[model samples]
Target: MTSFSAAQRSRVTMLDVAERAGVSKASVSRFIGDDRALLSDAIALRIEQAIDALGYRPNQMARGLKRGRTRLIGMLVADIRNPYSIAVMHGVETACRQHGYNLVVCNTDRDDEQERQHLAALRAYNIEGLIVNTLGHHLEQLLELQREMPLVLVDRKVDALHSDLVGLDNPLAVRMALEHLEQQGYRDILLVSEVADGTSSRVERLHSFQSQVSLRKDLRGAIQETGPDLHTRLQAFLAQDGAGPKALFCANGIAALACTKALRELGCRLFEDIGLIALDDLDWYPLVGSGITALAQPTQAIGTSAFDCLLKRLRGDTSPTRSLDFAPQLLIRGSTQPL
Candidate 1:
């Protein structure tokens, strides 16, 4: 008999198991697959004994592929560092585990080239479905993927994709935020957001804010993008005397953090110089001079629902496309207090 190292033992294959059992490879396959019941007790016992003796484990990916199911779900996130993405991904992962599927997440860092690369890699893996929280810059690739598998869009919608969508009701959420600010005596408002870049959610929020501000005679509102000029812009906005006490409506968590930093840089007293209300309640919201008021999206529920939509499609669901819009809960803090 020949001796084998641990590495050699780990490389043991099905053929090795069959040779050890003194049986054919087909017999071994039958013993391990759906045809197990077809194997006689004597042959099945030999195969089992050989497998245990050799510490053999079947390749689950290969087995799954043979059954036309890899049991893997893919998720593409625009920015993984965003707290909102992290929270939502947690929910998606939990749902996947419950349903005996695995999640493969790819972060594009908001780059079109990276987005295309990730999409290509995910397609090569034959993922069962896709959850997109990206800018959808690579529309051609996305459309192709949609043809191959069901896609669920999160937080943002791609034009002409016509797939399922899971996100906050942007119009209603913006309305709620504005209503809260107005109730707190914040009449002069600035909507701070990341550059729209054709992202559907941002556009929706911006349009809603504009429409609502126009409807109210007492309220004054303007929009700003978070960038290098943000600090200078903040200074100008703060210096203006009219429009009553002012407040900042941050469009999302990333924008909230950026605007807060700009405010700090401009030496403004938090909530005293300018009030702040932001979408997406981050963990550090309460630690600021005055806690930041926020419209918190149901991230976990949204993620779970996205997966549920994908599951339905995988199970032969041919229903019309769906749009699942969730609501946000307002959490009042010192940031939106009347000054």
Candidate 2:
């Protein structure tokens, strides 16, 4: 038996795999990631055997450097703590897996500086595309990135960046909640949302509430921007009023939880003292004091569509930048009805 020298042993490459398997280096490359148009089972098996026999690992860095394509997609989220973002991520990941693409995720915590850092790092990695759930403050940066790579905005929108975007139809969803609450004979309603001026979801939901409520003289509603003070303000509102707003329309899950806490703390029984309705449905919706009425967004569809849009852009099939918005389903429950 003859053993190869150290240098000879180290010199094995994709060419060696091709030679051993009686196939082309291109076949071996395609077999590793399996991203090519198609491959016959026999040819794929040969490549796999050669790779295993030669202890050959695909040199992803070398391939990226040579081809100038990383085959990586970067996903930036404003906050990982949000369930809605997580659901969208699951959609993105599912699509990426099916298409043989790798995803790198970054949490920006809605910070502009962190967002810039993540964008720069993804660029450094030579990522092929990007999916951004942005803070809506970095339009220039996002626009610049979009110019260089295929970009898709998810769940949030940056005003100046003319790119593919997928998000919930916030105004319409809020209107659904408002209409339902009105049907329950709730005249005075209070809309509560997070205190963020630039976030597209919050802004749109607030504006929609104001516009829709203003048209009906009998329906009195006021939008309150709150963060940490959400519970305190809600408690104060409930204490001072004649019969506190007949229904509390929470803009999102966070606000919904705050409203629930405030009501419980004040010993105000839901469905007895006031009605409750929330924008995004929660896991605990059914188990709460009274099941909360909510508008549930189509998270899976949002994610799948976002990936499809990104793939279309990556393939250079850009006819026009598409902005896809999904509507929410209103779930009626005891929280919004009088006991």
Candidate 3:
């Protein structure tokens, strides 16, 4: 019996397959790359038989690199802890797998320095495209990367960088929430949001709230940011005399959780003392007081659209930049019941 080293026994190479198949390495290459039709049927069969007998497998990454394509998409999220990001990520990953691609996700945790670092690391990885759901603080790095590959922005817009955008219609979503609250007989409204921090979505939602409130003479509105002062602000909003009944419009799930915590700490009753409606319907919403009313964004759709945009660009799409704004669906729950 012949003896073989462990490494030799474990490793199977295309060259070995070619030798066994009695063919040139070039013929093997063409066969492995799905160009088998270029060869004679006998040659194809021999290559196939050899491949099966040798248990040969191609290194996809190595092959992709040689062809200047990685089939890898990179996603940069501002805060991975946010439920909204997680939902969007799930959508993107699903689409990637369905399309025979892979996803690389980076979480910046809402830090500017971390965002910069992650961007550089993604570039170094030679990702074929990027999906960003972060405040675009490092413009130079982002612009450089955009020049090299397809870039898509999700839930936020970066100035000076023209690219495809996927997100909810902020103005429409705000209107939906406000209209629902008004119909539910809540006259005083406080829009609670995470500090804008230059996030376009937050700013857009805040602006929409201001403009929409002004148009409704019957409604009184205010804005509050989530922070250590959140509980105190909630107390004041609940205690102060307002238009009629008061309600808090949380801009997103994170804001909804923060505002809920503050309201609870202030010893305020659920919808009885105050009403609540939030953007981004979360799983635990129903478990809370009267099930929090919500303006639910099509998060999965947004994510899938983001990847599709990248795919188009990767496939030589040179069309003009697109802005896809999905509408929100309102879920009426006990929290929004007439007080």
Candidate 4:
């Protein structure tokens, strides 16, 4: 018998597995891919056993290359530190694994130069699709990438690209929160959001709050930016007299954190002196003063749906782009329910 070296013995190809399984290369490929449903139980079983016996690990990148595909997805995030972004990224990762694909994520940290760099890097790697969560400042780069591959936007709307979008229905979510606050005897409302810096979600939430509050004669609503000015603005809001109790509607998790900090510094009782209802549900929401009432955005669903949309486009679906707005589930806790 001829002796084979260690390196030679280590390489176990799908063809070797197919030969051992007494199946064709096409059959092995089918078993490896998403079309295993079309295979007979016996054939599938044989392939499985052969794979285990031969220690076969298919090179997905090589396989994709042969088919003119990369099985790689690129994601651009504005702020990777955001809790909402983390949750959504988890969902997208889970979906990609289930579909036999890989994800490459890039964080711009809300910087335009970083955005341009990340976009170029994603293209250099030959990613099959892209899910954008950045500022979309480099339109020419984005348009060029769009022509090369499928693109989907998450939580932000860039008018130039007009790609598929997945995010919350801000108007409906704002209305629901206001309605809940009104029913809880909170007549005065303050909407706290990050500064309007071309971020679509924040702008939409602010617009919705303003539009809805104007229609209700009994409710008076105002907006505040979450940052260095929040503490002073919040103090002013606390001093304002109203017909009923005052409540704060935080636009997102970042705003919630800022508002909570300011309230703590002011030595105001949490959820007792003034109610707080936030848009994105963070894990710490429960631990903070009898839990903050929240409209929990379906972050995982939004992430998974964004990937699904890109998959469709990758598979030759040239249909019109879609904008999916998932509804938030309102979770009422001790904060919103006055004792």
Candidate 5:
């Protein structure tokens, strides 16, 4: 009796399948490989039987090395803590799984250096594409990456990079807030933002508020820009008698919460001392003293659109780079009206 070495017994190859099935090695190889054109039904059945009998599992790493395409996508989000980012990621992950692709996620914490490092790591993995929820600071680096791989921008866009973008209509969202407030007889409105430099969403919201207020002479001078220390500054502004804007329009959920805390500390009564309206309907909006009124962006729609845009790019549909903007819906609550 002859004894087979441990290495020989452990190894499983196409030749073994061919020997078991009584067919050529080339026939087994063609059947197991992705190229279906080279396989016939009878040979394919025999190859499948041989594979099951031998318990053969092909080496995915070797297959990837040979094909040079890994069917993986990299998703870079500015902040994973933000609810909006998580919603968008849900859409991306769902789309990837449906198409036999896998996603690798990286959170940049809105840091430029971190963004660059993540991009490098994703490249090393040879990701088939990218879905970027950007910080809007790394324009040159992102533009260069776009030239090398297909990328879709979500929520925020880099100015220099011509890529598909999916986000809420910022100007319209702000307009909705303003209109709701106006109808409720609150004319002295203030628009508060965290960053002084202003993002696309912030700038667009401010501009829209100003444009709409300009038409009505009774409206206050203009919307106020609160500094980074919004809570403290807002409290100080409200302390002075008739000094600050009577109504507040928060740019997003973050600023809205800060404003809420300031109001609570100041012992301010909702719709009596001041009116409040915010963008992005938050989870805690309804739980507040009086529910906060807001212009709600369609979070699911934004995510789904982004995923669809990425899929189109991957399918070689090189149509014009598109921007898909979802309209905002106003949720009326006690915050914007008198008790």
Candidate 6:
């Protein structure tokens, strides 16, 4: 018979699981921690069964203190105003809580100085892992942190940092958007994006658009960045006489919003005078005029995967660095219709 009451069993701990499994605390820890690969199958099964039976949960806060891990994960966001960032952050927070970790998110607002300051603040808190979504301008600080903990990059790629990456499959997404445009009988395509700002995602999308246009001899593609002059540039595109139907392909949600506003200002009919499809669908996509067709990135999945990559490293799984690229789901809406 167990010495403790049923009440004690209800408040099960790692010690309870270890005792019930007839194993040492170290062995039980190895089973739950990142070093489970070191344990034999039989031992692993025993520990799992014991945990299940006792309903034991690891007190990560207490355990982290003992192991010098704070069970805190840090995320650096470039533009919190961007819908994509907000959606991804929600996913990260959900996954962190599920895995007994807490998230400390810092929004740099796409500023380099703020990025540096946030990185320093995250380090001060001794975060066990980091998931970054900003342009990694401060290389020295990033490199220093990577030495002590795991880092996973999302959406943007930092040069010379060989860490796990969790992001959308940009090439595939670009291809999908182009193909949809072509199918809808759009020949002249204007790919509008925000300024590259050294962001890998934007750069890749731009490059992909150029490449796609090159391969499709019948199609002509032009590039424009959203800025104060977006209205002027878009007006010129609308006036230009092209071979066939002209459509605006927004590289992401921000670009879509900007281009849509420009079209509104020009008093151009949506999808009647110009067709449009954008990347990274926001909730307001359907509410827009005739709805905006989109190649929607699995933002939540990308965020959750980034945290999972960091968690694996924190748990001591020192295997090859992983790159998780999720595919987009094409949501065909009225915006991509032919004239």
Best by TM-score: 1
TM-score on alpha carbons, each prediction: 0.91, 0.85, 0.90, 0.84, 0.80, 0.81
State residue 92's C-alpha deviation in candidate 1, in Å. 1.3
TM-score-superior candidate, 1 or 3: 1
lDDT of 3 by residue, 1-339 (tens): 345555654598889989999999999999988687899999999999987777677777788899988788999999899999999999999999999889999999989899999999998878999999998989999999999999999999998889999999999999999888898889999999999988999999999999999999999999999999999889888888899999999999999999888888888888898899999999999999779998998999999999999999999999999999999999999998875
lDDT of 2 by residue, 1-339 (tens): 335555655577889999999998788778776475477889988877876677666678677768877778889998899888898899999999999888899999978899888888888888888998877576776777788888888877777778888989887887788888877888878898878668887888888888999987768887776667767777766676533347888888888887788788878877677888987778998788769988998888898899899899888886988879899998888888743
The candidate scoring highest on lDDT is: 3
Q: Which regions of candidate 5 deviate over 4 angstroms?
A: 1-62, 196-198, 221-228, 240-245
Assess candidate 4 and give its TM-score to the true structure. 0.84
- Per-model tally of clashing residue pairs: 0, 0, 0, 0, 0, 1
What is the per-residue lDDT of model 6 for residues 1-339, given as tens digits with 9 covering 90 to 100?
A: 235556765598778888888888899999888899998898889899988777676766676777897879999999898899999999999999999889999999988899999999999888889999988989899999999999999988997888998898888998898888998899999999999988998899899889988999878999999999999999999898996899999998899999988899899998899999999888889988889998998988988888888888987999998788999999999998865
Estimate the lDDT of model 6: 0.89
Q: Write the per-residue lDDT of candidate 5 for residues 41-89, one digit (tens) a residue.
A: 8878888888777777666556675798788888999889877788779
The 0-to-1 C-alpha lDDT of every candidate, in the order given, reads 0.91, 0.82, 0.92, 0.92, 0.77, 0.89
Q: Could you tell me how far off, in angstroms, the CA of residue 21 lies in candidate 3 after the best superposition? A: 4.7
Q: How accurate is candidate 5 locally (lDDT)?
A: 0.77
Q: Which lDDT tens digits does candidate 1 get at residues 149-218?
A: 9999998988778899999999999899888888888889999998998889999999999999999888
How does candidate 4 score on lDDT? 0.92
How many steric overlaps does candidate 2 have?
A: 0
Please report, as a residue range, the 10-residue window in candidate 5 with the lowest summed lDDT.
1-10
Error of 4 at 227 (Å): 1.0
Identify the superior model by lDDT, candidate 3 or candidate 4: 3
Runs in model 6 lying further than 4 Å from the true structure:
1-67
Clashing pairs in 6: 34-315
List where candidate 1 sits over 4 angstroms from the true fold: 1-10, 19-49
